[model samples]
Target: MTSIPNVTLNNGIEMPQLGFGVFQVPDDETTAAVATALEAGYRSIDTAAIYGNERGVGRAIAESGIARDELFVTTKLWNEDQGHDATLAAFDASLDKLGLDYVDLYLIHWPAPARDRYLDTWRAFEKILGEGRVRAIGVSNFQVAHLERLMENTGVTPAVNQVELHPGLQQEELRAFHERHGIATEAWSPLAQGAVLGDQAVADLAARYGVSPAQVVLRWHLQIGNIVIPKSVTPERVRQNLDVFGFELTDEDLRSLAALDRGLRTGPDPDTFN
Candidate 1:
């Protein structure tokens, strides 16, 4: 089994720096995919209610015989479930679907500024945290302004902020802000959904390291201190993704990758995605 390093959240909970994500994986295939990841020594699994595969994730966890405490499970609340009452109800539904009494971390899937319910929804998250149903709470797809407002109006600061980040969209300013505020930056599309794999710099580094382009990217993510969850349904790719802890990228190589950032976004804009 591979020993994945743990990133301690602001709340003192330790999460695997690299995890497996089931973003586009269908429900039926999710179980086998998750099982493959687990067998490959992955302890953290990222899923969302919106992904509609929490049940599949749960099934894999149940059958793995891997003790619950040994695994870290994360699921998100959907955009429609943004209000306080609705958020709580939706969380219960997610817990039910996951077949777990408590989740390692729960996040608001998006800020959804137009709805203006995240503040209210976060209060419910705090409530859930207080009851010990969740180890930590956080938000996803939140911009700087949204994070500032959330901290100002709320009693608890988010432990992690999951977002679409890749070599093409480095998010330097946002990551700096997270560092200042002690929030862990978790990247969803850490590889740019295969968009960054074709870059000359990435390929050169991959060749130098004798590894795949995806491993180079994933290594870059870890070296830069981002908790990355790379999704792959293929068993070989799933194992390959976890094999990124062996090498380290030097400062020059990092700069080369940094220069590749063109502010490319592969997902919806958080500021306007109401």
Candidate 2:
């Protein structure tokens, strides 16, 4: 099995730097997809309640015979489940669906600033963490202001911040803040949902490295210190995505990719998405 490097979160828990994501994958297909990833040496699996595939993910984990401690499982609370009580209840539902007693990490799927319940929801997350039901807690798609308010009003800082980040939409400012605050930056659409694969710079890097464009992009994410979860239902692609630890990009190559950032966002705006 390939050894995936671990990124220590703000709370001191180690998470695989690269993981498999089940974003759009249907519930029925998710099991096979997750199984393929596990067989390909992936120890981390990212899913969400909104994805409606937690059961499939749990099935794969149960059947894999992989030790629970050897695997990292992550799930999220959806937008509708944003209040303290609702968040706790929703988390129970997620655990039930996942067939696991504890999750490695749990996240608030979005800020949903209009609802203004994330602070309350995070308090519940703290409660969950206190109960030792989760190893770490985080928020996804949170902007700088959201993070600022969260830290100001809350007692615990988020361990990770998962967001839609790709070379095309390199979240430099947000990432910098994460570094300053000891938060791990986890990228969801690390490849821009295939939007950045065709970029000339990425293609050139792939050619130079004798690898695929996806590998080049994934490698960029790792080199730049982003915990990236790339989703693919195809067996070959799933294995190929995890085969990104072999090469290192030089400073010039890194700069080339950096210049490709156009602030392109493939998802909803965090501040206004509520």
Candidate 3:
């Protein structure tokens, strides 16, 4: 089993740096896929209400025999659930689907800036945290301006900000802002949906390190201090994703990977998305 390292969030919560993501994973396959990830030594699992697999995730956790305290589970509030009242109701629904008394972390899945209700949503998150319904609260796809406004309005800092991040879309500015605010930057689609696996630079690094291109890319994310969740339905790949801790990428290799950033994103723009 690979020993995954933990990153402490601003609120003093320790989350596994490497986690298994369930994005785009079909509902029917989520349970088995999540089970494979757990069996492969992944203690952290990231899912959401919009993902439509929280029930399957709950089923896997219920059957995995792993104690609740030993696992870190995360879910999110959807765009339609952006106001304080709706956010609380949505969280309750998510929890009902997840069959958990409390989640390790909860997030606003997207800023949906146009709706302009994220502030209200965040207030609910703060209340949930205060009530001990969640260990930590955060946001996703939040840009610098959104985070700043959120902090200003609510006077509470998000523990994390998850976004589409990979070698191709480094999000340097947002990442720096997160660093300055003591918030952890977590990477969704960390592999860029396999877009970077065939890159010449990553291929070369993989060859040198005797690892797969996916491993090289995941290692790069870790070296750069990004909490990354690489999802895979294949059992072998699930195990393979957790096998990145054994090797180290050199400074030169890190630079080469950094140079691959093209500022491209595989998901919606946070500022514009509703």
Candidate 4:
């Protein structure tokens, strides 16, 4: 079993540092893929309403017969679903599809600065939190400006901020900001969406630890205190991702990995995506 420790959220929830992500996972194949992940001992499943696979993921969990309390399920509100009432309706729809009364984490999918309604959306999230329908609430792809505005306006801080973090795009400044605000940083594309898998540095680290490149990347995220949710369809790779508990990365190895951070990104910049 992986020896990674669970990181406590601002709300006192202990979530596994490494989770299973289903970003591009299709609806038809979502169930089997999630079932495989559950069998592989993944306690956390990260999905989104935009992914259009919530039902499949829910079915997998229901069929697994694993008690709801034993799992941590996270989903996000799409860009089109912003504001107080719209967000509540969206949350209910997502919950209905997932077959859960409450979610472990619910995030604003994007800042959508142009829409200028995340503050309102967050207010709705707080409402849900107060009702105890959701264990934790958060944001995703949020820049510093967005976070600051939210803090200034709502006077509520999110439990986590899921971002596009990988060895290539370190986002050190944002991570520091999250640390200052007591918000955990969760990495969405932890593998750079497969862009850094073949890098010589990652390859060398994998060779040193007798693990796959993915394992080395996931381990690096763990060392940096960032929760990582790596996505995969193949059973072998999914299993390989979770078996990163034994070895420890040396200081020298970590320094080398830091040098690999080129600030490159495979996803659209949230600041201008809208």
All candidates' TM-scores? 0.99, 0.99, 0.99, 0.98
Model 2 C-alpha lDDT per residue in residues 1-274, reported as the tens digit of each score: 9999999998889999999999999999999999999999999999999999999999999999999999999999999999999999999999999999999999999999999999999999999999999999999999999999999999999999999999999889999999999999999999898999999999999999999999999999999999999999999999999988889899999999999999989999998886
Candidate 1 TM-score to native: 0.99
- After superposing candidate 1 on the true structure, give the runs of residues whose Cα lies further than 4 Å from its correct spot: none
Query: Cα RMSD for candidate 3?
Result: 0.7
* lDDT tens digits, residue span 67-124, model 4: 9998999999998999999999999999999999899999999999889889999999
lDDT of 3 by residue, 145-244 (tens): 9999999989679999999999999999999999988999999999898898899999998999899999999999999999999999999999999999
| Number of clashes found in candidate 4 | 1
TM-score of 4: 0.98
Tens digits of per-residue lDDT for model 1, 1-274: 9999999999899999999999999999999999999999999999999999999999999999999999999999999999999999999999999999999999999999999999999999999999999999999999999999999999999999999999999999999999999999999999998999999999999999999999999999999999999999999999999999889999999999999999999999998897
Error of 4 at 97 (Å): 0.5
What C-alpha lDDT does candidate 4 achieve relative to the native structure?
0.93
Model 3 spans > 4 angstroms off? none
Off by over 4 Å in 2: none
Top candidate, metric lDDT: 1
In candidate 4 the C-alpha lDDT for residue 262 amounts to 92
